[model samples]
Target: MAEFKIVLSDRETGRSYKIDATGPAAGALIGRRIGEEIEGGVLGFAGYRIRITGASDRTGIPARRDLPGPARRRLLLSRGVGFHPVREGERRRKSVRGNEISADIVQVNAVVTQRGSKPLDEYFNRPEAAAE
Candidate 1:
């Protein structure tokens, strides 16, 4: 069975939430590419909508939107998702995962598109229990 750690970003509040998806929720995410939108019910949040923004494989290779499949490839780039430029006209081969999600992906990044009737703070803003 596949497992995924979903990082949901709430742009309005500039806050993020982390949830672990297992069983059916994990299965539903497999094969979904970046930029695709899925219902929040899939992640146990009914009435909310989330859009996949990016994902990373087990080893932390970020999925690039311009790339097509689930395979990892090294591409020469001056500056982009995987590569960062330090000097002028610098380019190097950097490994990056494709846009598609697969079993190898361990983390998925997403942004909330539609909010449910209840505000998100109600869900994630619970106060921490005090330590005795």
Candidate 2:
């Protein structure tokens, strides 16, 4: 039973969540393409879904190049890419081991695609939920 640290970030909000997951389910997340959706319950939440956007190893180097500018900046900044913080909450800080995570630790970047009864509806009045 190995535990892997995962960081899930909300695209709309600049907030990131650190979830510690174990077992084969967490392992399956590796290599999944961006835009793929996963159950949020796996990260200990319900009524929510996560869409994978990017991932990185212990060193904080991105696994993909298509990440949005803000997302990339957040990841790098969390890994201490810039000057040291002068105060608390200066930059986005990850709760997981800072740059020293195990090789199996995959920091995942994701956005909440669904919450409660509402799926993220980009199209106004389309009501795509009925098709699901």
lDDT of all predictions: 0.90, 0.54
Cα TM-score of candidate 2: 0.49
Per-residue lDDT of 66 in model 2: 41
Prediction 2 global C-alpha lDDT: 0.54
Q: Highest TM-score, which number?
A: 1
Ten contiguous residues with the weakest lDDT in model 2: 93-102
lDDT of 1 by residue, 1-132 (tens): 999999999998798999899999999999899999999988888899999999998898899999999999989878879888999999998999999999999999999999998766667665551221
How does each model score on TM-score?
0.92, 0.49
